[model samples]
Target: MTATAAAPEEDGTAPAGGGTASGQDASRPVRQIVPPEDLHATELAFLAAHDSGPRPPGWRLTPRSVVTFVMGSHGAALTLPDDARAAAGTPRRLVIDGKFVGDRALVERCVVTLAGERALLLVGEPGTAKSMLSELLAAAVCGTSGLVVQGTAGTTEDQLKYGWNYAQLLAGGPSPAALVPSPVLTAMSRGAIGRVEEVTRCLPEVQDALVSLLSERRIAVPELAGGPDGLAHATPGFNLIATANLRDRGVSEMSAALKRRFNFETVGAIGDLDAETALVRRQARAALERSGAAFQVDDAVLEALVTAFRDLREGRSAEGWEVERPSTVMSTAEAVAVAGALGLAAAYFPGDRDVLELLPGHLLGVVRKDDPADAARLRGYWDGPVRRRAEEGAATWRALWDLRTVLEG
Candidate 1:
């Protein structure tokens, strides 16, 4: 029988009529939030003695189960025993969220690189979802996403290494208490994936701090008097994943040495118009639903919006028509945002003609973020590719093109 009662006060005292009268079943299991995968590194090694598979040392489940945990599986349902299950609560459904939207082969390549000994660097334009994917990968591998170093202009060697606590440093003179481990150091000790986001944003000197760490698989702290002699040795399954934005080109370029340490993968922007449209539609619907608003967007309006973005992104249209691309990145995330704006407009205006009426203006707002020269690029796209497509008797696109003045005005 299930028991429902108000929780007791924090002073360790019960309310009136305490003692089991509250119908409290003290033996009930508390809910937990574990990853969908059944095993962890230590547990996997213990199971390896009885089970049969290619078990990598320090990994919880076999590599195959790890894959299923991340991508979801259709075979036998993997489960944890009641004891383990109750201790950790129910496992999170292995729902692989967006990281990279483009190539499966690239993801496979990254997975393989991590499975081996190499570090992986995900390079892409801003808002292309590189860091998100890295987070997902790290969470999948180690069952934790807490190890991270966010790269920036002000990031220092100490931020990536150990920093001395001033009070402890003065008291004990570089003792272990004075040493505070950076995220990278902690990940090395735990054998988990350490993430560094916006890697190129860090100044060259600061970025170089990773070179020694990756090559040696250890962090050396000369000042700390009594911590592992000199080096902080990495545990067995430790790895690193870093993300750099390509749009931030020419700003603090990565050293050749650091580049060689990682297997680089460049994530591309959404190229297919249909794919972009579908993604926008799905994302917008979900957002509206979350907001407790009814999603009533027209499919044709979404297609037009995506087509405009694709043309501005690629500097061309589907039918061999030339268009001037925008200086801004026409990312999938931005497409979803624009679609969401239109949805909001629909919810408010109710009769704002159609969502297509808001497309060109939203496109203009995004493309005109930086240089005024971007305005010319956007106008060129409409005149060339959009004009050609409209002239070719594409009805829906023609209607959107008719709103070209929205860009100029």
Candidate 2:
């Protein structure tokens, strides 16, 4: 996903979608945020019940079942064969919940890559949910998504390998107890999933550390050469999932050697307007509910908001008219932020205020980040598209166009 918001929104908390995808358990007093591993345990258990298929070493699910788990059952119940059910010694109702929404073919390829225990790279624009997809894949393939290293400018090679525990190092010198394995090292030793978020953000040198770890499937520890803990070899079922922002590709480009070891897949924006709108609303409402705020935002306002974002995002109106896009990324994640902000204002501020009017200012805020000239780009968008829509008898556009001075100011 390209950077969704140019910068993090003030209230950028992701809506809690955990173990319960159908609906929150009413028996729960408060909302709980669980990791993908914990969240999908029940569904995984169900799938495993019916899956008598051969699996790769150390894998929890077969590649076919892994895809089914992530893509969901498409409103159909996944019934097991009578023989398989008998083998499981339990009733099977594997409702493969649809979690991630994108190309099914691409998802299958991702599942295949992990099944092969090869590194997989998820590349896309910000807010494209690459991170989420990685989590889901990791959890599904190995049954754990907690082993992770967040890549950044400050990220070090030690974060990908091992660091010394100061206390143990001081007392016992170089030993296994003094060694603190990074998430990557731990994953290699235990044969679990290890994730690296925003790989391009790491320094080139630090990023290169992956080349050997991935190629050899192990890490050498000269400090323990004569002892029992000389090296950590990757067990079967160990793999790495790294996500990199497409927009940041050139910043710290991965070495060709590192790139060659992994399969690459790019995730794109949601193509269907209604699908995208429904997702925005669903996530927004979840965010509202998590905050214990009543969702009072109107549907039309939401439709208009998503429409405006879609328009600004692609530099064109829904009617196929041209509109200039700002330099900033207008990701769906940003739309969620705007919607969340509007909903909060409606619940707390409590007025007969036109929620739509606040849109221009919020949009202005989204565009006026990163680049100084993006402000001018936003103005041009208003003058071109907003002006045409207003003149074409769109009352909401006319109202928004009336706030032209807001941008000028």
Candidate 3:
């Protein structure tokens, strides 16, 4: 049966005691990462009003609009129809910015999978924004992205299915008041999308807990059997989206049965250099802005940073030169982080060192993460690409080539 959507707080988070805050800090930190629901609340509301088409059970926006929300409007302004504008009370026109930098078809497929209420699994190397995509999808499909179970080796079936409040359970026996529902269970009852991050990291048995939930679409509560709350049936809109790091392939393999339940989508690194560089600059600027500082890193430096990361990540250079790949994944996410660090350094330590001078050291840090031997591989990269570019009269490469001593120490 279809269930009405729960009213979310202004921040798009579930109300207190709703079990969405499990494993989260009670107090809000100053520099906290905002959830997609809160970050794009206006976009979500606007899209909801913009698209008056039919939505699947419990969805906030139509399937087409959900895809548009994730992939953006392609620099065009979206306007709400007159009836929607008057009723929804949102802006008449809004230009939605693209959040995830990937193929639009991939996002369309994801939206279709969610519309079908099937389990969606996003698998990729670390930092491909798999989790971000999952959050965006959940926030758009439902009203909130707060229902989450962070899967880890220590994860238990209780975390995936249900748990109990010791005090309540002690005072009263096996009642709804005494039984604490997990985020998944809460999502089932509320008919909202629930997210499981790093699902493969959970123990095999722990991960298998979801097999039955996905197949049966309900959790049998033997404790409350024969009562009104005996079986926790999933509301019409309930579904799950999970993410796994390809790097963590063998930590805890998912059961074959569990794999069959999910539609696996592999999220790969960005293909175009200019797009990757733009994303890095944009994210780095946002990071610096959060600290009340301007991003002063040069465009050339940002492009170089991304280029080096791509080279190390792909084991080949832009000029078709073969370079040694590092054991650690030189992900685009890491490039953004390094770019942000460079911006922070430039802003706080003005004139102390050229941001270009800091690039080699940051590259060294990223390379040395997995193997100390990777340090030499980075040096080989410098001697190969950096040296070649320097010989070609590129000033940026010359400056980077001059910093070869940084990698030596």
In candidate 1, position 264 carries an lDDT of: 95
Q: Candidate 2 at residue 332, lDDT?
A: 86
lDDT of 1 by residue, 24-103 (tens): 33364422222222213222222222224564555544555444434433332333443333223223121122323466
Query: What alpha-carbon RMSD in Å does predicted model 3 have with respect to the real structure?
Result: 7.2
lDDT of each: 0.69, 0.81, 0.86
Query: RMSD to the native, candidate 1?
Result: 9.5
TM-scores, one per candidate: 0.77, 0.88, 0.92
- After superposing candidate 3 on the true structure, give the runs of residues whose Cα lies further than 4 Å from its correct spot: 1-31, 85-89
The clash tally of candidate 3 reads 0
In the range 1-409, model 3's lDDT, one tens digit per residue, is 1112334456443332211222123353533466777666667878888888899999989999999888888777777777785334345666676888998889988988988858999999999999989999999999888999998889999999898888988887789998889999999999999999999899998988899999999999999999989999999989999999999989999899999999999999999999999989988887777677889999999999999999989999999999999899999899999999999999999999799999999999988988899999999999999999999999999999999999999
Residue ranges of candidate 2 with Cα displaced over 4 Å: 1-33, 80-94
Q: What's the C-alpha lDDT at position 348 in model 3? A: 91
lDDT of 3 at 105: 89
Task: Tell me the number of clashing residue pairs for each predicted model.
Answer: 3, 8, 0
